[model samples]
Target chain A: MAGRTARSERAAGTGEVLLAVAERLFAEHGVFAVSNRQISEAAGQGNNAAVGYHFGTKTDLLRAIVRRHAERIEALREEMLERTGDSASVRDWVAVLVRPGTQHLAELGSPTWYARFGAQLMTDPVLRELMVDETFGPTIRRTLEGLNRCLPELPLPVRLERADMARNLMVHMLAERERALAEGAHTARTSWHAYATGLIDALTGLWLAPVTTDG
Target chain B: MAGRTARSERAAGTGEVLLAVAERLFAEHGVFAVSNRQISEAAGQGNNAAVGYHFGTKTDLLRAIVRRHAERIEALREEMLERTGDSASVRDWVAVLVRPGTQHLAELGSPTWYARFGAQLMTDPVLRELMVDETFGPTIRRTLEGLNRCLPELPLPVRLERADMARNLMVHMLAERERALAEGAHTARTSWHAYATGLIDALTGLWLAPVTTDG
Candidate 1:
């Protein structure tokens, strides 16, 4: 039993190191451009097939990276949802939607790779479906339902369109902020908290904005 | 002289074909993942080095693709600006901001690649500078000035933040719509013109949204 535990722990450690290395490399190089072999080599594995051995395939490796971040983000949102309850205002619900991401990034501190990596997945057709399946499951669905419950009067199509807009804005803007933070460049908002505040405010307006033209 | 003119025209024709092929491939595949050799070969050039011979670098090729569209977008916005000429309504200025790209995309008809291609460039760090320099030059500056003139009372930081949000929403949303069209999937708005109208409405609300927390 002791020997088995030791071997399992070592395997877990290797997985963690591979995930970290893969995330950083994917954030630096384009996801499709970086091979499984390169990620394994970067993780200091003597066996080039280490990634295959550990993660199965490149897509599986990408999912592992996303799942790592999504798990934390979901937990953050779940806690926020507890605080919010059914009485949540539009801004509160938007906070539920946006804060998990910014907060997670803030908690991760500098040189984080999740935002850039997530943004790329959000753009890729196959990878986006994988990410949405992983991240936008139970917790996100509940949050959106809560938000929609509050937005009872908005037209369905308009609501859907703005939701799409909000998601895009949230993902892409945070990606930009992350990139800026990594590069030590100037950002208009000083901190992640401030950035989320700005986003929630604008999104509040966006979600509540009157629909003029009907689709 | 006639033979030289014919040769130049033939070369220009090849360059145009290469640009079209490159844009489509870059849109379908991530920009960095697609090679100039692949682009040349995809364009049916016998020499795989044709991309290099025609365009000095990958960035140069990307720029050439952007320049091809920028000229058309610039002309469209110039016409719209002539009609707007310091209109104080936020929506009018927002229209000036949103219309040109969507209108250009609409004019390009179904399965256009520029939006997706441009969105990738917008997200990329090094290429974003090229996109802004090439596309965000004088006309955008003037439009922003006019938009600011309309909202003299809005806080500078809020204005800047909303501007960033608007740009992100515009680029990414158009990219999504473009992708959906390419895939023959459902989209909220049926036409690009309507899409711009929806964007302008949402942006008007976003820009005029009361600043909740002062930066």
Candidate 2:
């Protein structure tokens, strides 16, 4: 039992290293540009098939990377949701929607790769669905429901369009900031907290914007 | 002289075919995943090196594709700017920023790939700079200047941040709509004109949103 426990722990350590390496590489390079063999090699594994052995396939590995981040984001969202508790303000719900990811990036400190990695997944034709399924859970739905309650007059189609706009803005803007920081470039906002605040303000306006034209 | 003209015309036709093929492939598959040889083959060029012969490098090919579209978008923006002409209303400037791309896409009809192709470029780490340089020409800058004129009270950092937000929203939102249309899926807005109107409304709000926090 002792030997088995040690082996399992070692395997877990290797898995963690691989995940970290894969996420950074994916963030730096395009997700589809990097291969499983390259990931295993980068992780210091002698066997090129180590990623396959550990994570099954490329899509599965991509899903694992997303799941790791999504789990933390979901936890953060859950905590924020509890604090929010049926808030009537669109900004409050927008905060609930936006803060978790930014806060998680903050907790991860500078040069974080998850934002860039998530953007890569979101941009990919096949992997977007996986990222969405992993990241957007019950907490997200609850936040959106809260947001919708505040905007009863907004039409459903416009609501949906703005929702897509909000999601795209959130994902890609975070990625842009991450990319800038990673490259030692300047960003307009100094901190993720401030950045999220700006986003919430903008998104609140976006959700509450008058529907000027019919679909 | 007549033979030379015929040769140049045929070459131009081949270039157009290659651009169309490359854009669609890059949209369907990730940009880095598709090769020049594959593009040449798809374009019915006997020489696998035709992409290199016609366009110097993969980056150059990508630029050529962007340039082709940017020319049209620039013309559209120029016309819109002539009409907008120092307008103080944020919505008018927002429409100036949003309409050219959407109007161009509208002209392209169904199964459009430029939005998807451009989104892929924007998501890419290396290629994003190329796309930005190729597309964000003088007209875009003028439109933004006009927008800034409208929001004289907004802080520079918040304005810059919201500018980034608007861009991300525009690029990825159009891509999402194009993707849905390509997949024969339902989109909130049936036409690109309506979609642009919806986007303009949301972006007008985003730009005009109050700055509640310091960056």
Candidate 3:
């Protein structure tokens, strides 16, 4: 029993190490550019087929990374949903969706390659469609349903139009933030928090303007 | 003089043919994935180096295609400015910027690759920055100046923020439209036109909202 426990702990440690190496390399060189051998080598395992032995393939490894990241996002979403009860406004819902992403990115000690990987995925139709369907589709659907309920006076098309616009704006801002960080804009002064707050406030105003009918 | 005219016309025709083929190939495969050989072969030019002969390199070819499209945009901007007559409403200016893009895409008859190219460019820092500097920089600056003069109550950051959001929304709409088209949706039924008009109206409302508060 002691030996089995020790082996399992070692296995968990190895898995963590593999993920750490994969995240950095994937972020730096993109999913297509990085190889399984490189992940193993970088992890200091020095085993030729370590990635396959563990994660199966490069594509699988990418999916794994995405899955791991999605869990964090899912948790954030759940927490936000819990905080935002039935009487939440459109602006409140927008805040819940946008804040978690920016906050998660801010808290990470090192800049991960996920953002770059994501940028590449935007151009790749297959991966792009899959990621959208899996990650954003359900979340957006739920958010929109909540928003529509909150703003029933707004036309369905109008609500969808605003939601789509807000979503695109968020995606573009995230990409822009990644570019700014990559270009050496000091995170201390121009933190993701400042950027996210500005963007969310602007987008929230845009999305909520239609329902308010004052605009 | 007749011979010179003939040669010039042939050169122009060749350039057109090369661009036509290059655009088709680039749309089918991405800019990085397609090769000069494929473009030349598809264009029915015997020499695989025909792309190089006519346009220097693949990057130059891509630039030429973008420049061709941009010329139409520039012309539209000039026409809009002329129509505005120095005292345009905020809505009028937004309409000027939004209408031309929607019309151009509708009329261009080119494959949706241009839209995809644009989506890729937005996420690409080098290309995005250059595009803002060269193509959009002067026009945006002038438009903002005009808007500020017309609507002085708005804050500078608010103006800049709305402008960025408008541009980002436009790009996203184009990309989404292309996807819809690919999925067999008719252009008339697509949400792009409605979305653009909605966005323009929203921005106009935002711009005019602060005025009402002061009054």
Candidate 4:
């Protein structure tokens, strides 16, 4: 048991190093522009096949990075769900979804390459399809289901439309925020939290307006 | 003078043919995936250098296609402005923005490829940056300025946020509608127009909700 634990720790350490190095390279150049050998070398592994041995392929390595970030996001979703419970309002759900993403952006050592990679992936047919199926689609399905249960009075189509609007706002803001950062803007002072809150307020108002009228 | 007019007509005919062929090729296989030779042959032109003579390079060809579509969109915007005149409601503006895009989707010869090209363009940094600077940026700036003049009650930050939401919703809907079409969904049954109207109603509701509260 002791031996297995030590080996697991070593493997995890190696994986962490590889992810850190690959994230930087992929951000600076691009997924297509970078090579596994370069990633191995940068990770300080003398073995050229280190990437394959650990992650199977360059594509797999890219998936791992996305998955790592996604896992963090998923955890936040769960936390938000638990905190808000069954009676959570539309405003509460919006805050839950938006806050974690902005907080992730604010954190130190969060990959600067993710925004560029995400933008590039948006155009990549295979990657986009895979991500839609694997990452975003499932998350969206689950989130919408939860939202629907909470907002039963709202029509499905309307809920879907609002959800789409919220998502687009989030992605657009993230992309713009990244561009601002690249252009040497001080993101620390940007007040993304307030911006997010304002967006939630706007969307919530829209969602509940009809109900208010009926009442 | 008669001879000059005839010559210009001939030039326009060939230009249209080249554009038609270029759109088909670039849509089926991405811009990088398709070649100038393929475009020439597809257009029934014998000369491989025809694309270069007409548009300079592959990137230039893409820019031309984008510009062509953008012009139509600009015309729609102008028509909407003229029809709505000085007292255009938020719903009027939203309808003007959303309706033309759906109409463009419906009218295109190969909507699938056009959509793929659009999705690619949205995420692509180089293409996105260029398109924004040359095409979308001017239109959006003009629209925002117009909106600010008309809807002075809304704060600048709020106006910008709403504008961002509207643009994102359009992009997401276009991409989703295209995907549905690519998967062999019938246009009439899909009811994208209905979807657009729903979005417009929801967004207008959101934007106007605050104003009502303030009043």
Candidate 5:
């Protein structure tokens, strides 16, 4: 029994290492550029098929990496939503939307790769649906509901469009800042918290922008 | 002399075909997923080294593709800037920033690949610099200058941050719409013109959003 438990623990450790290596490689190089064999090799596995053994497929591996970060991010969002319960302020709900990812990145410290990985996933045609399905949940839907309640009169199409624009802005901007910091380049905001504030402000305004009738 | 002229014309024709094929493949598959040999074969070149022989390297081929579209986009921007001379209204300057790309896309008709290609380029770390250096030109600088002049009160950092946010919004939003159209998915706006109007409204608000000092 003890031997079996140790073997399972070893397997779990190998899975964790593969996830980390895959995230960093996918972040630095394009996702399609890196192979599962490459990831297994980089993770120091004796077998070249370690990634395949631990994870069923490349998509499954990618999904695992996303799930690792997303679980924590969603928890943060849930806490923020609880605190922001029944608030009428768009900025408050916007904070609920933007702060979780930035705050999670902040807690993870510098040289993080999840943001960059997410940017690539969202940009890739086939991979984007996986990202959407994994990331958006009831918490996000509730955040949108709270935000929409704050603005009762916005056209449904406009709301949907702004939601997409806001998501793009948040994901890519976070990735941009993460890439800059990793490369030792200049960043506009001093910290992730301040960056979240900037995003929340701009996205708040984006949601409130008046819709034009004529093209 | 006549044979040499005919050879050069055929070379130019192959280059155009290579560019078109590369863009579409990169859009459909991830950029790094598609190889130069694949691009050459797809373009029906007799030799597999055709991409290397014609464009020198993948980066050079990418730049060539960007240049092909950017020249037309820049010309459109020039015409818009000429008509929008010295505009103080933020929306007018925003229109200058947004219209050129949308107008160019409209001219390309359905199933356009440039927006998706541009989105991938902007998201990739090594390739983003190429996209920015190719796309942001004298006209963009002049538009920003006019925009800054019209809003003299915004802090420089806030202005820069908002500019990045607006850019992320426009690039990814356009890519999203183009992807939807390519996949026969539903789109929020009816036409490229209306899409531009929607973007212009949101980006204008993004620029005009009030900055928060306390973070």
Candidate 6:
């Protein structure tokens, strides 16, 4: 039992390092353009097969990177979800949707790459399914259910469409800000908390926006 | 005069084919992942240096692709601008920002790659600058000026922030819809016309949305 625990502990350390290195490379280059060997060498592993050994395939490596961030984000979201407790306010509900991801990035501190990395995954057709599959579950669905309760007047299709808009806004905006910070470009808001506040306000407007039903 | 016209016309024809093929390949793969050689080979040019010979560099090639789409969208926006004529209605101003690109896509028929190709460029760290430089100029600035004239009540920072949000929403959403259409996935609105209407409606709400000023 002790030996197994020791071996797994060492594996966990390597996994963390590999995930961090992979996220940075993927963020800078691209998920598809970077190879496993490059990741292994950049990770300081003498063996070229370190990435393949640690994570099975390129998709699997991508998933592992997503899972690392998603777990933390889900926890943050779950905590935010608990505070709302069926609040009917549109702002509160929208906060539930936008804040967790931004707040998690905020907590992660400066030079974060998950936003850029995730944006790349979301934009890629084949990888988008993997990202959605790995990251979304009961938490996000429940947030939507909570948000839906607040916007009952919105039709089903419009509601779904607005939800899509909100999701895109959060992902892309966060990635933009992250990129700006990395590149030393000016950001409108001073802090992530402030940035998240800005997003919640815009998204609240988006959710409550009047739908122009097609004729 | 006839000889000169024919020479220029032939050059135009090659340029058009190259831009179309590049847009398709960039949309399917990625802007950076696809090389000039691959693009040339797939474009069926016998010369391996066709992209280099014609467009000079990758950045120049990307600019040409953008220039092709931007010219048409600008023409459409110009017509829309003429009708707007400094109208103070927020919806009219917003329509100027949203409609032209969608209308151009509508005119282009099915399986269009510009939206997806543009989205990928917008998301890339380096390419996004070239995209903005090549595409945004007096036309977009004029539209924003027209939009701003109507929204004097909103704070400048919020206005700027919302404008950024609006741009992100439009680009990413259009790309997602284009991807869905290409993949034969179900899209909410049946046509690009309807999709633009939905975007205009949502953007109207976004612009008109009451700002939550950070204290």
* TM-scores for the candidates: 0.91, 0.93, 0.80, 0.78, 0.93, 0.91
Tens digits of per-residue lDDT for model 4 on A1-215?
A: 97796576467898887887887676556555579999898777889889999999766887887777776777766676667767776667666767766666666443366656665555455566544444573445665676677778886656765776666567665665665666676543255455566666676666664521211
Q: What is candidate 2's lDDT per residue for A1-215, written digit by digit as tens?
A: 97796566467898887888899898898887789999999877899999999899888888898888888999999998888865458888999889999999999898899988898788888788898899879998988888888888898888788888888989998998889899888877789998898898999888888888644
Residue A10 in model 2: lDDT:
69
Clashing pairs in 2: none
Tens-place lDDT digits, model 1, residues A1-215 = 97796566467898887888899888777677689889889877899999999899888888888888889999998898888877888878888999999999999988788888888888775577897788776777788888899989987878788888888999888988888888888887888999999998899888877778745
Residues B101-211, candidate 1, lDDT per residue (tens digit)?
998998887889999988888876567789878887677778888899988898897888788888899988999889889998887788998988888888888887777
Per-residue lDDT over A1-215 for candidate 5, one digit per residue giving the tens place of the 0 to 100 score: 97796576477799997898899999998888899999999877989999999999999999999998999999999998878868459999999999999999999998899999999999998999999999998889999999999989999998999999989999999998999899998887889999999998899888888888863
The DockQ scores of all candidates, in the order shown, are 0.50, 0.70, 0.26, 0.30, 0.71, 0.56
Q: Where is model 4 more than 4 Å wrong at Cα?
A: A1-18, A25-53, A108-111, A137-142, A186-192, A205-215, B1-18, B21-50, B109-112, B137-139, B186-189, B209-215
Residue-level lDDT of model 6, residues B1-215, one tens digit each, is 97796576467787676777888998998776789999888777889888999899988999998988899999999988888775458888888899999999999999899999888888776788888887786778899988888888988878888888998999999998999899998887999989988888888888888877566
Clashes of each: 0, 0, 1, 0, 0, 0
TM-score of 5: 0.93
CAPRI rating of model 5: medium
Model 5 chain A lDDT-worst window of ten: A2-11
Tens digit of per-residue lDDT, candidate 6, span A89-188: 8888888888888888988999999999998888875688998898777789998998888887888878888888888888888998899899898887
Candidate 4 lDDT over residue span B50-141, tens digit each: 98898897778887877787777777667666676667666666677677676666666435456567656655555666555544645456
lDDT of 2: 0.88
Candidate 2, residue B114: the lDDT equals 93
Clashing residue pairs in candidate 5, if any? none
**CAPRI band for model 4:** acceptable
CAPRI tier for the interface of model 3: acceptable
Worst 10 residues of 3 chain B by lDDT: B206-215
Q: Using DockQ as the measure, which candidate wins?
A: 5
